[model samples]
Target: MMNILNKILKRYGDIYHPHKQVMESLKINKYLYIVLILIVIEGLLGQYMLYLNKDIWGIIFLLFYGMTIAIGSIFHFKYVEKKFGSLEEFDLEKMNKFVKLVDQEVKIDLTNKEQNQIINQMILEKLERENIKEQKKRAFTGGIFTVLLIPILLPFIIENNQDILILTVIIMLVGIAIIFFSFKSILKDYSLKYKLERISDMLKEILIFSLRDKSL
Candidate 1:
């Protein structure tokens, strides 16, 4: 059986490719746990402050706290999106080169029917899987921000407390659940990472082969 750290490392590569080592070095796993704890602490503070002085300092704290989470969450989502977007482009470039190679080879002499069909199927499957993975990543990021902000914002900006607290609790639960579920999914399946590594290897092979042939 794979050790827990090995499993986490595998998932890390899946979620983050080029920056996998950087993020891991930063101990993102520990950072996330700290962030979650801070969030819960902030929520409790908000609830407590609701009963205390509604003074300027209290209001400022509330404003700053909310802004911290809201702004930070937005930046986090954008960062992840940008990273994934780059990887997606890298994968597409590899695929485009593969297609160009096929076209060129066909112009010289068509590939065997079985080889062509197999390559086509592999490309299609890879593209399909990458698309699904991207969608999931986007959804997870958006869901987290929406869940964290909507409930907390409603309580602060409006006058009603009855439904807001209940909603806040619900949203908190949902956000935590989503994070946990996403982590599980990443650790359980390395399909995205596997495909990425495969593409990188293919690109390297093609470059080496082209260089050798040129030398000949």
Candidate 2:
């Protein structure tokens, strides 16, 4: 968990690109990690409050959950100046279309627009080639399994001892976080896959229309 938090809490070091920013800037700054830590504490506290039948306090603590988003957004704006290489590796400009077409496309028989269309086709193919659908499937399966296992473990988590119950709540919190992020990632991947499918369908329709015109 510490290792995972360390990665999440990555701070920009001396990463001057000297040319171009090759990654997306962080949406949430490192200092928001404090808020995130507070979030975990809040969860534990909330659960403990509820366990102690302090329902009002539990509700109050739950309301503070919104602060995580508020603090993260504030930090995002505050820490807008990110180093080049320190950013995430999700920049679209850095993605590949075709290595072979680098110089050859300059003198090819195809027009500029046609070459661009071909590159778009290559990009689509490359994106789909990564098999995001399969990954989404795996993530969903794992997430569902973990969620289902939570109920099974809940009997054990619900106990008479205060300390034991709190510890179990902590364990449950970790499991819940895993499920949340896993499904979140799956949804993101599914959204991208859906968009790519739409684009691919449109491209295919255009190709078929062009071919039919040529045949006529």
Candidate 3:
């Protein structure tokens, strides 16, 4: 059971795993880690207030908790998009060199319709793989957000009046479902946009290489 759980966590964790340069370049990881700690602190405060029967203060703490998450999420999405969209830091120099080397090694008639079609197909395949990665990244972010919220919310609900607790639980389940689906939709849209932007850069390189042999 432990192994299985570990595997599940690993699978989900991969999405949020910053690329090697992500931490160094953006410093987003440090900011996010700090926000996460703040969320935990606010959640604890909320729970403590609820325990003291101060429902209003508890609600305020919870609202602040949610606001912190929302702010962090917005920052994360913007930073990620900015980093991925700007290919300046990307090692395209190496890719260009590789493409040039391949051009030299493989004598392809770029003017031939069939050869041109094959190049297009290869570009499409590259795009598909990138799309898959984008989807996984988005899903991973959503999953992490959902998992973190449960612990924060559970304590307040558990300590409440039984009647209110039952109603809250029902409402909470509905809310969770709504949130999960909403995140899926939002993330999917963002992922596609990000993937398309990156693919455009890659396709430009590939096209430039393919057309190099053709006399205009």
RMSD of each: 15.3, 14.3, 14.1
Clash-forming residue pairs, model 1: none
Candidate 3 overall lDDT versus native = 0.60
Off by over 4 Å in 1: 1-124, 133-166, 186-191, 197-200, 203-207, 210-216
Residue 117 displacement (Å), model 2: 3.1
- Summarize candidate 3's per-residue lDDT along 44-99 as a digit string, tens digits: 99999999999999999999999998998788766655766644433454345434
Best by lDDT: 3
- Looking at model 1, residue 177 earns an lDDT score of 76
Please write out the lDDT profile of model 2 over residues 87-157, one tens digit for every residue: 23222122211112332433321223475366446646646654766677677767766787677566656
> What lDDT does the true structure give each of the candidates?
0.55, 0.52, 0.60
Query: Among all windows of ten consecutive residues in candidate 2, which has the lowest summed lDDT?
Result: 5-14
Give the TM-scores of the predictions, in the order they appear: 0.29, 0.35, 0.32
Error of 1 at 120 (Å): 8.2
Ranking by lDDT: 3, 1, 2
Between which residue pairs do clashes occur in model 3? none
Q: Any idea how many clashes model 2 has?
A: 0
Q: What tens digits encode model 1's per-residue C-alpha lDDT throughout 117-205?
A: 44434545655776688678868778767877676667655766557666767778877877787777765455655654465455455
Better of 1 and 2 by lDDT: 1
